[model samples]
Target: MRYRHLAAASLLALPLVAFAQTAPAPAPAPAAPPAPADVPLIARTQATVPQPVLGPVDQALRVTPATNAKGGKIHMLPATLETTQWGWFDNAQPPVLTVKSGDSIALETMMHAHNQVVPGTTIEQIKKTRTDYPGRGPHSLTGPIFIDGAEPGDVLKVTLNKIVPRSYATNFNVPGMFGEFPKEFPDGQVKYFYLDLVKMETEFLPGVFIPVKPFPGTLGVARAEPGRYSSVPPGKYAGNLDINEFTEGASIYIPVFVKGALLWTGDSHAGQGNGEINLTAMESAFRELNVTVEVIKGQKLEWPRIETKTHWITIGYDRDLNIAYDLLQKETVKYLVETKKAPDEAAATKLMVTNWDCRISEVVNVVKGTYCMTAKTAGKPVAKLPTAETATAFVTVGTDADLNKAMDTASMAMINLLVEKKGLTRLDSYGLVSAAGDCRVGPPAGATKTVVCQTPKSLWRTKTASK
Candidate 1:
């Protein structure tokens, strides 16, 4: 049951509405560049807004992505910063590392077997590795990477680049693990696969080949709730989503929760069918996963969805297929209303009935789910959060206490632009300058001028209704 609701973030109605009709308008030119490191943002804020603790701005906000010397994306070690310790995905857990939008991460994921099924591994020995795994689900996880500037009400785009197979991968079915036909295979089954990374496929049996469609079966961010969370269920936050669409070259867009969108993923599956009815995909230990994780501001989503080269996939999970089915349809309807902006909800439903392909994602994860995909037009990207390099101020608001330092925390670029380029006095710019706090345009209460992201008006036609 815990594994069933592996997704942690809930699917709320979003304002990033471009789902229905043809192409969305082209995005306007990006605002100016990030202010020079030496410039300060302290001059144009209210006396109350807190100055931000200028830690690493992270390459995410920069013009180019962060890179390493080896020409590979930054490598994330399981035991390193921001990475998770075991398998469970808890938002309350601190991040092992901080990355930025458009950053590539090459992470090594532990197998569902963890260290249980090595060459001399045994069942009795494997049980010890699953010590606290009952509610945590089965696999070992790698991270809770903190993406800079990510926050609740935003979106995180996970683009799969590559899945490098490790030397060997393992698979097993416990006695009661596959509930549908529990009696069919009573004894636990442990099997291993010799990875063929070069060929990109694995053998199920002689002459029976299964293409290696490696995807993180349990990829997601923390739920808004603060506590230990199960990696079993797939929710809006997309943990253990298990959908096959998450294979290489696909993109998963998830709603952001908590600042920096604490994200983690694992449960590498070399292959699996839609229902995963028999339990487990072609399980594998991935040597490396090349992924680009970025933040999309101004986009809102109710569910964790997928965009492949061919389809727009909507997902829903629940304890009951019937309920999950309804949730799936409702999400489709929301897709019609928000993204499609269908004037008639009923009409959208009718069209959806004709176009959507709803399939069983899984039935065993106590939390069953149905994922529906519809033929979708490609090319239009969800309008991004505004990027005003100048004239706009930004800030980070953690507690009510941070308000006092707002002025100091504001971007120096904003102050410089208004005073130097735009010719507004510091106080006047502070008056009209807006942070994400309160939308008041001119010195309205709580202007909290700090590094902030606001929706650009032109993209109003872009998508979801704001909460």
Candidate 2:
């Protein structure tokens, strides 16, 4: 989210709601001055862009093996994980990582303020980085992973398997970049926070401790457009959504624009309210992101939607709140009709109104969003998950070296991960392809120290001739 202030017109005319599990207001601080803008952005020549290597699955990017808490093997993504290089939601940018649908990803994420705003960082350093850093938008995002067979009008179903905060987080207030009350705190201020991951709490102020619910602030796919778009707002393809419900165990469905559904994610927030209220939160670098992104062919979506194990949620986004509300209504109705084939519109409306509640997903972004949440209790059903299918390629999870060793013999088409083998074994299949693990034998998880192999297949068939 931007921390720069603009003319009064930028302020939300409506009373925005900063939804939270428990909101305890912090004491007031001085009005902060506006944060500085980055230098203007001009498209770079192809020479500046790093052309993808040899093929979709880079042999060189193979990662080493690592152990999960359970001592089973998991993957950490290839060192090629995007942190330094990032792009807008525009389809123009090439995907940094490529995987078939149902592949598991152990992604790493960075804080919004980025390296310049980290602890021990100085204003001078920030100003210096701004000179070279493209100023197209705010937040440091990683991704745009190309999903095989994904194309425009498809929906990417992302399941957040695990999210752990790497170390510290940050919260800042820059003059023009925060809330409408910019004059209240002149000049910007950034604060660092030490996390207690084991305890799963962080101190917001001296007396209050905020529960940590880590989620990427921005999660989106490249838009089909040729021109670059700013990541400062939420869109139909999804970005900077700041939806708090998207924590671990949640599933988000984002619209696909490109053939691979270049999904990008970053702006890690340890905890945040709906409106975000301020410009930042427990913004932090993240480690051990266990996510599975599946492509549901032909399931077109207009806006991004989310679902927790207990609730089915639909989203509506627009610059106009009224328009957002109308869209939300339609989305809810459509969901009901598709899932239940309710007798009539009135019955569907009654079911939604009587059984559901709404949350203002976010109001601070230039494009606001609202979500309709329906409970999934005893008999009530939730969104249908993608049925099991064969995996297109092997998604090897382990440390880089472990994966490399395994690939040496497995010699199958491999997408390596550097991970926490969370739930890697629970799924009988990896969508379309059978998965094996431990880097030595196959692709999923095991405690072995060598390359795991999958059963022999066609050209890409893998072997487990242990070394």
Candidate 3:
């Protein structure tokens, strides 16, 4: 696997790798006279330290009560409760804090739940509670500070510093509720696993240890709509986007909704697979996340874009995979054409066909939703063609030809197809053959070849391709 170092521009004020192993000690006592209360907060802090705060929640919100439950009793706080079930608390909104590059943040949390043990409850009950009060259950939430002067059309960069889950827990479906293969097992079965909150440990398998990398499953800002919106589905405002890659050191760009884009983040997870098949992971209560946010003033995006140390990922969620693929293809084509200046459709198609580096990331959630990503950096560039003297005399292939002749014939056939079907000029065809052509034969020995041609820089100097 290829791993690129995080961009220096995105690593705002954050310490290197070893800094996050433990939290920093409290700042030393002030040596001189205490500063005046009237002094501006930003100016005062900026004078002392160049780095800005990355998290909106300050020291004040860190205080939370710790609780646990076993058997069937709400052990510690029975006086205030009507039933044995654990009760939910007020849903705190995520802080709208600005994050600059190189800064890392740490958070502390305690697990609190309303349900101690309710054997007869169904999926409906859990769903109802979650619906009535969001952000009270195991949730993921975190936002980064964007670079100053990032306009609307540009992208806001985020690099995750560290994601550590303090205490963790996983819940299984109750009897007659839900199952992985519901059609095969209708009755439903209940299983639960509890973690040692202090140790921060879990046993996913007999000999495996799953280290926690906490991240908010629903991290986004407010929508463009006037009133408050439910944090269920992701929209233009970027809410409840359950993308799993928002970990430490992974940068994300969200379209700005309002000035300063009040971003709210909550929902931390230990780990999860694509589509979150179970609608949950090893759901945990307490988490610490460090992030940096940069503002992009004018760069507007239709959907959220994420970049890890390795891959560039674009997410498309639609009701149909075909539609999603079409959108993905269009967006990728646009990126290639606009950025690389591939002049015409034929050149672009050749690049896609010859490379085949683009692929479907996942097919899950397609019936209800589809998520797909196309990568630009995964494929090797087409090789430049040989000189005219070495050009293999072109001949069309047919099914009747032998295997070796068929291969050569197929290449010629593709050349012809490019001229007839794609309406390429003779120069265009020749340039394509010389610079960007290759062939691959299938298992049954059928012949196939793809021709690739990149537009000269001068073409884009005059006009650009549009989606």
lDDT of all predictions: 0.57, 0.56, 0.39
Per-residue lDDT of candidate 3, residues 259-360 (tens digit): 445555544455443333223444554445555555555555776766777655555444343355455545545555655636866676555445433322
Q: Taking the tens digit of each residue's C-alpha lDDT, what string does model 1 give over 1-467? A: 12222222321111111211111233486986889999976555575788786664343332234474434346455422234344456666666667767777877776553434455566445544444233345666787788888989999998888877566655444444343334533555555666676766554433334456677787888788776655666778888777877788899999987888887877777766554543465666677787888788898798888889888788777766556656777887888777764667898787676554555565556676667776666344433223343233332221122321221233223434445644555432321222101110111124332222221122112123311
TM values, all candidates: 0.63, 0.64, 0.49
State residue 140's C-alpha deviation in candidate 3, in Å: 6.5
Q: Which of the predicted structures, 1 or 3, would earn the higher TM-score when compared with the native?
A: 1
TM-score of 3: 0.49
Residue 247, model 2, lDDT: 91
lDDT of 1: 0.57
- TM-score for model 2? 0.64
Error of 3 at 60 (Å): 10
State residue 349's C-alpha deviation in candidate 2, in Å: 1.6
Off by over 4 Å in 1: 1-82, 131-133, 341-343, 378-467
